[model samples]
Target: MKLFVDCKKAGHLCDKGQYEDASFFEKLSVRMHVMMCKQCAKYSERNAKLTKLLKDSKCKQMPEECKKRIREELARELAKKPE
Candidate 1:
């Protein structure tokens, strides 16, 4: 098993881990990278905080009618735009 990872791969793993979609090895690699890289560590920290905030929030979803109206407005705007 490869123990080291580059920043980009580390970042991807961080996001996947945040969503509980990464494998154990991938999460481990990301943890190792975060331990050594300050920027990635900060990024991972912020991502975790954001995830927690989103999970904790009591936000409601828009109604279907509201979503339909927004889509209609977008379609109208796109029709008016030049090709």
Candidate 2:
């Protein structure tokens, strides 16, 4: 099952804080996997940085009007795209 838990999915789990609920065996498994997976370790670091950036700016609010306009533009762009 170790092969099933590749760095990508493990990184996703780590991002979602699944480590808190992981069993001792699972934790050891992930630890061992990450030790050899530089790509996953880098992914974890990027996730951490992004999470910190988002949390630190949690109070900064986007203007509703600006958001609406951006959404509308995105919708138009999406509509123009071919399936």
Candidate 3:
């Protein structure tokens, strides 16, 4: 198994770890990368904070009809734009 990872892989692993989807090796790679890369460490920290804030917030889900309408509107707008 690879013991080291780049910043991009670290970011992806961090996201997967947050959702409990990363493997043990993937989590270890991310931890090692974050320990050495300050930027990635900060990125991981902010990602965790954002996840916590969103989880704690009492945000309601938008209705499916509303989401469909918004998507339709965006499609229409994009279709009207010149290539």
Local accuracy by lDDT, each model: 0.94, 0.70, 0.93
Off by over 4 Å in 2: 1-4, 18-29, 62-83
Candidate 1 vs candidate 2: which has greater TM-score?
A: 1
* TM-score winner: 1
RMSD of 3: 4.2
- At residue 7, what lDDT does model 2 achieve? 75
lDDT winner between candidates 1 and 3: 1
Candidates ranked by TM-score: 1, 3, 2
Q: Candidate 2 on 47-69: residue-level lDDT in tens?
A: 66877787778576789999999
**Backbone collision count in every prediction?**
0, 0, 0
Candidate 1 segments exceeding 4 Å error = 73-83
Clashing pairs in 2: none
Ranking by lDDT: 1, 3, 2
Clashing pairs in 1: none
Q: Residue 79 of candidate 1: its Cα lDDT? A: 88
Model 3 over residues 1-83: C-alpha lDDT tens digits?
67898898899999998898999999999999999999999999998998899889999999999999999999999889687
